[model samples]
Target chain A: MPALANLTSREELLAEALGEGWRPGPPPGGEAEDAPPDLLPKALPLSQVIRVDYVVPGCPPPAPLIGEFFNAFLSGEMPEPGYVFAKVKALCEECPRTREERVLKKIVRPHELLPAPEVCLLDQGMICLGPVTCGGCSAACPSAGMPCTGCLGPTPKAGDMGLAMISALASLVRAGEEGEETIPKEDEILDALVDPIGTLYKFGVPTSLSPLRERAGVRGSSSPYPVPYQRGRGGEEGGGR
Target chain B: MKKIVIDPITRLEGHGKILLYLDEAGGLKDAVLEIPELRGFERFCQGRRAEEMPQITERICGVCPEAHHLASAKALDECYSAEVPEPARLQRELFYDAYIFSDHLLHLVFLGGPDLLLPQDTPKGQRNVLGVLQAHPELGKQVVKVRARAQRILDLIGGKAIHPVFALPGGVAQPLSQEAREEIRGHAQAMVGLAERMVTFFHEQVLPDPGIQSLLLAEECRLPTHYMGLVDEEGAPNFYHGALRIVSAAGEEIYCGDAREALSLIEEHTEPWTYVKFPYLKEFSWQGFSAGVESGIYRVGPLARINVAERMATPLAQEEFERFFDHFGERPVHATFAYHWARLIEMVQAAEDVARLSEEDALTGREVRGELSSPGEGIGVIEAARGTLFHHYKLSPEGLVEFVNLIVATTHNAAGIGLSVKQMAARVVKEGELDERLLNRVEMAFRAYDPCLACATHFLPGETPLAVEIYDAQGVLKQRIVR
Candidate 1:
């Protein structure tokens, strides 16, 4: 992995981001034609932008975890700044599903399949992000028969969640392909994945490794999303109450 | 002309600003509510799977995510043309009842209750749930216990307390185990007893309060509008699913049918200044916000539900229901403050249903899911914690969402809330005499509706209260009143 320290110069970074010879102040045209009013186009993650002190992971930070945080807070025994007050494990570890068949034969949308009880949703070809998501929610969605949407952000070991998931999915598909006689190649199953970005990078796209992802039939931004950062969780649930 | 802006922008989900235009004499001429509309929700859900909607749409509001989840689930059921099994329906209703009990209790004890429980002179910081708790610690403790119990039941059945993920196209995700069923029964029976205690508190402490009485009888608080809610075949309040019923201001049945026809009956009127759209009956059309037979103005909430339904399904609630109408000595109580009182009445019914549905044999049945046919256009309507919530979707043959439209409880009450604020603003915001108490009176007109727009129910400390800025015609911020 490339060190973030290696990419020090903001000018160089911005130049690379906008174009090879790009400068600040919206080009020679004097005004940015961009539609979305992102406070800072080059906005970094919370840790990157400023000094941070502790985090309780999970979309809303589950009740039990919050209780733990409050206890630690009141006692003045807060852990280090980088310490996230949540289970430091993948969601799949906590998921109560039997994972005997760690293989993806084919991809299926949520409506196309009725997930079997006590079986891993990913094993049933549903694109659950449990393997790549943080475990603080205790596999809440998976237990309920819905695939995990990775709302707790990434787990500690799962660096670059989308890519980590891709690697995991490839190996899972390859394992299935090794036994299937009718299957020509792993490409058949891999190609069947629908709405790739929406499914995989649903939560972390704003601060993603590569935010400006371009594809065929993509919009002007290669994504029409104006959800800069705060509203980045388009499925903005689990806050306020 | 002077303009007064009441900006309640503290809540993160959404912010609303009320612009009160005053004439030279300091008399109110017009009022407009400017709230930021969350755009792109429809577009966001467009290419997503129809089955994924229940999870996605629930994020619209933190306060009533369950409402969105169930409405989306039912809509998906319609899209797939699935006949949800009796077991699943029973489970859904049971879950809904618990939700209603919890949510209504939340509004009663925390949101609207404080306004009446505490004195008007109470400090701005203390005039909320904290003050209510300080006043009645035992009641507060009991309320907290019941709320937690209800939420625990929600977590068990819906899979999580806040944004539930159990509902699917044809039915719920999993069958209720016998253990969970018995657990729900135990919790629900306790809640029923607690609901009755709530009424005892209401009659003992709330009804006789002189300030509350004046607010109830206030001229500005009255609006004779059409009432809408869901009713069972027996014409009783059924929160989960039922035929749509609309009763006129004069206590006559205006329309009774399913959601599709109800959708056709109401038309949305939009304005240039605010994203808040006014939904009114199409029969009378948009007749300029007045409450009469000629205007399309209609309301949906506790007051509307009770007015539209013939009686409460449960006996205890039915008895309270009779006493409620008797106290008013009227059919459709036009007093807007009655919403708070009516909310308590509904809480009784919700608790009763929670206890009753848990005893149903179907609730514990193994067959929680039914078969689905093909994907198509569908509309689902349910009475949310606040009011009638609608979720309409058109799915592609492959089950991807082709179209999406959602009318949450707040949207349905937009026009009524606007008019209520306007009327109150006219009475309260006098020329050269504006105070925080007077502005709060205007806000009282709003909070009574309990329209949890932008998840406005929970207010964290340090967040600004309803701020009023009186501006001259030239748009200079002249006098500011903030709490």
Candidate 2:
């Protein structure tokens, strides 16, 4: 038999059926000449026209898990149509790091210092989203000596992985300490966050509690975060989180 | 006359469609393969820390994340003006070989094997890995075992089987353990055996079948286009380190040397219907889409790599390379199906290189990093499994990415695939006598190229199913095939 054909968008399908002179409408509010086409709208629209079967969650699901899914499918043991996921609820459950509660005096970038192999990266002042992201990858990123950016998306209990991480970072910052005049201010703490949208919603923004448009409060805006970072500036105070 | 749209070409990475326009007399008028998915990746990369590119860019495509990761890392090295330590370079090459071996093996056995093993008219449901397993149970078991072993090697070197984070700006993030090195040596040996088995299988099973052999040599599968790839100092195929080489259709050397100069020799042409841009030779002056020798179109990947290289680096692969040339009758094999043959040869070279790298003591050394400096503009190029991949970035002095551009392997073959599809559609769907079998033949032309539209377009997860709709000249639907 021939190989499979392409999976077309709703617009392409409609245009093919409708003949010539049919073009898709400009995206809401005409964001830019080119923007990352939102996949949620394209993928979710199919549910209205056809029966939705199964949903496999992951930014890019692990290969072994995919193999298992295929094996189960080929063997006729696939479960009923719904969400099929790993048993572990959060990435922290699968992480091998030793966790401890301690307030951090400052935020450290991964490139600035080599993290210890055994301790929690977040505790080491590095921004790791394992606490709020889903597991099933066996903590692949952390095991590789890199912090997890939450590619597995938010855990079921978390409304938004980015917000949860922001909250986590805020609580971890040295705050409300008696007579600690050297404690960093709230703005400094927030400034250290760096590319907040990129960190928080790297993979979950499209399907997050606060979608891009809602968060930006502007249709077709490239950045979902309301706070804007000043470009070409050299200081920490130059850009806001 | 009619128009048929094969939307979302299936069994490959990402989303793309094939449009066939026929005249009222049922003669083929025009054919175009369009990529509709766009992630605006360059825009996404802008303003992000240059150091984070390796991690961020790998998420572009699941099939070849290693390629992106390594390419981005190399680009960062240049951006920071840091010379990578020797041991780190060795480790990176070793990790990359494992990736190439596993990726090529997966494509051959899981994706492209069924078309070679099963009959062309086999039912759609059985034209996949499951069917291949049922037909050749022992070989199927070996495929799984070999792929698992390859993945083990990746995990050992990079600390993750998928989307590895081992590469750093000037060096690798960690040193390889002695135990891990030993483990990899064993797996590498096994991979050599697996590669040998694949060669034997291709020669014994695929070549002997008259029908398949004829199809392999079919006119629809031939394209007299230029070939480009990376080659070592001795002009041998080098996946990790090499200079770019381009050879014309008639086996004449066109250009060789610096990748930047080579990149300057090409330009991209955009069509309003597709998001993916068509890259053609700048020397040809953007002549629009056309087929045959004068079209100024070129191809890159396994076949192109083998065509441009003087010989394979490893002994066994060199012998196989000689045999391949002897069979095909010369360099620059125009038959696109020969991509499979070329891919198998590269697999042998990769496995052998892995074994060679595993035996080296440098892999276990601790000096894996180099000092970093202020950021600047840089470019990284590599021979990914699909073809040559380029990642160019410009960073602010503060190390923030100011600009980004990527020309993935799939994009290089985009124009070539379009031409191949046109030729196949004209040959198989003559006079509007369309049928499922003929459509399969058209798809067969596409599969030979192994085009990964997802990587080309830079969007979403892999493996989207494809569907095709046939419309008459009057814009009335006739039939639809969902695979």
lDDT (Cα, 0-100) at B139 in candidate 1? 86
Residue B379 displacement (Å), model 1 = 0.6
- Model 1's A-chain: what TM-score? 0.67
DockQ score of the complex predicted as candidate 2: 0.15
- What are the per-model numbers of colliding residue pairs? 0, 11
List, residue by residue over B1-483, the lDDT tens digit for candidate 1: 677667773322356666677787789888766554323355456667677788777776766778888999999888989999988888888898999999888888887767767766467777778889999999889999989999989998998988888898989887888999989988998899899998888889888988888878877778888899999999999899889999999999998987666888878766444444578888897887688666788989899999999999989899889988998888888999999888988999999989888988888887877788889999999999889988899998777888777777777888888889888888786534887767777777888888765632111112356677777867677888777
Question: Tens digits of per-residue lDDT for model 2 on A156-189?
Answer: 4554677778787767777456445734474476
For residue B259, give model 1's deviation from the true position in Å.
Answer: 2.1
True contacts kept of 2: 0.18
Task: Determine the TM-score of chain B of model 1.
Answer: 0.95
| iRMSD values, candidates in order | 12.0, 11.5
- In terms of TM-score, the best-performing candidate is 1
**How much is the lDDT of residue A211 in candidate 1?**
38
Worst 10 residues of 1 chain B by lDDT: B455-464
DockQ of each: 0.17, 0.15
